[model samples]
Target chain A: MTRLELLAPMTGRVVPMEEVPDPVFSEKMLGDGLAIEPSEGLAVAPMAGSLVVFHSAGHAFAIEGPESVSVLVHLGLETVSLKGAGFERLAEVGDTVAAGQPIVKMDLAAIAAAGLRSISPIVLPQLDEGWRISKTNAATVQAGRDVLITIER
Target chain B: MQVKAQAYLEALGGPANIKDIEGCITRLRMTLIDPSKIDVRKLQAAGMVGRPMIIGKGVQVVVGTYAELIGAEINKILKQK
Candidate 1:
């Protein structure tokens, strides 16, 4: 079995997805994953892979993950409407990114003042069957730290 | 604001073009069939906070706090049509 690591994209307390206010995320409609009560606004790649979906809106970006899993990193609630106003894209679409590499820098204060929640969800929308996903319970994690999600294949 | 949201969806290729709808705090994340059908200028004129993008066969629109509501509205509009 191969073990893959999903790194922490930002420095934050890892919360169960249920802690996320939105049903879509909290309920795991998007897929099984954890939510981060972000202390910083910098979003990074959780695994080294191609940048498959980089929304210009800056609210979200998805990295094609290792082992064919796709990871969607959504920053804040409705922060997309800010239109990149407070987000600085460090990487472009189709670019290859490494785990924990800085991909987007966000203005946390601007996002909060705009009345948006900064809870970021790191989701595996296309999690494959037979792959086991495990997470660390309610802990503060640093960006680029190894394996927030330990995947057993 | 809801009316504007509807209009914005219409501008972005309508509900029929939408394949899947989900939302984050401030954006209505959707997978659409065609990205070319979107009218970015109209959405901008309507005071949309951000430009829509075609990401991995999906369209993400920044609709602020009303994102979830708009996602529901898109479904309703799709059902109606």
Candidate 2:
């Protein structure tokens, strides 16, 4: 059965990427993805797949895994507008990025000194139309870590 | 609704400097400086439109496809800056 899978978008602790509910305020929050600063190291493809979307700034990407999982990487929220000013594009659209391949290298100091965080967001684009995503306990994830919810299609 | 929306935008540092906004399935992604200062409730209460969800110890706001629209609004706002 083709199942859904997640791969590490960055090289860092594969902590369970989850949403935090501020019970006091009664709200929920999204994980910043693998929280690692730019250039602490390079973010790699968790798995080899087709590059579905690549932002112009070269900070984020999406991939449809071999198992039919869609993943998104928001490198730095507003950084996209930087227009590749502080980031270097390591891969091009339609290019097959290999797992653990070097996609882009960032200048962490410049980003932080400029008051930006290196924490990026890697997400499963959708919950397959007719299916519910099943998951195990959230674990610390590193680049290439298998931390994903399988869509039972 | 107008008043509530303003309150949230203010908490998010107002409609100023907001260059873009977008989200994944569970987040109302905001791109701004010192993201640490975001008052999600203020933004939510201000009627930005979206539900806040808690997944994996993080906060997310639902903006739907309008997320891109909000982002464009932000971009337009940035042009003046």
The C-alpha stretches of model 2 lying farther than 4 A from their native spots are A14-39, A129-140, A145-153, B1-81
Clashes of each: 4, 25
Give residue A100's lDDT in candidate 2 (0 to 100): 60
lDDT of 2: 0.52
Q: What's the residue-level lDDT of A129 in candidate 1?
A: 90
| Candidate 1 ranges with C-alpha deviation above 4 Å | B1-81
Write the residue-wise lDDT of candidate 2 on A1-153 in tens digits.
Answer: 555455556655433344212221112122122333233546667567877666556666666666565666666545655666677777876777776666676666666776765666555544345655555354444565544344556
Positional deviation of residue A149's Cα in model 2 after best superposition, in angstroms: 6.0
DockQ of prediction 2: 0.08
Candidate 1 C-alpha lDDT tens digits along A1-153: 988888989888888888899666776765788988889888889999998777666777888866787788888876767877889999998999988899998888998889888898888774779989999764889888746787887
DockQ of the candidate models in sequence: 0.06, 0.08
Look at candidate 2 and tell me the lDDT of residue B74.
Answer: 48
The deviation in Å at residue B55 for candidate 2 is 26
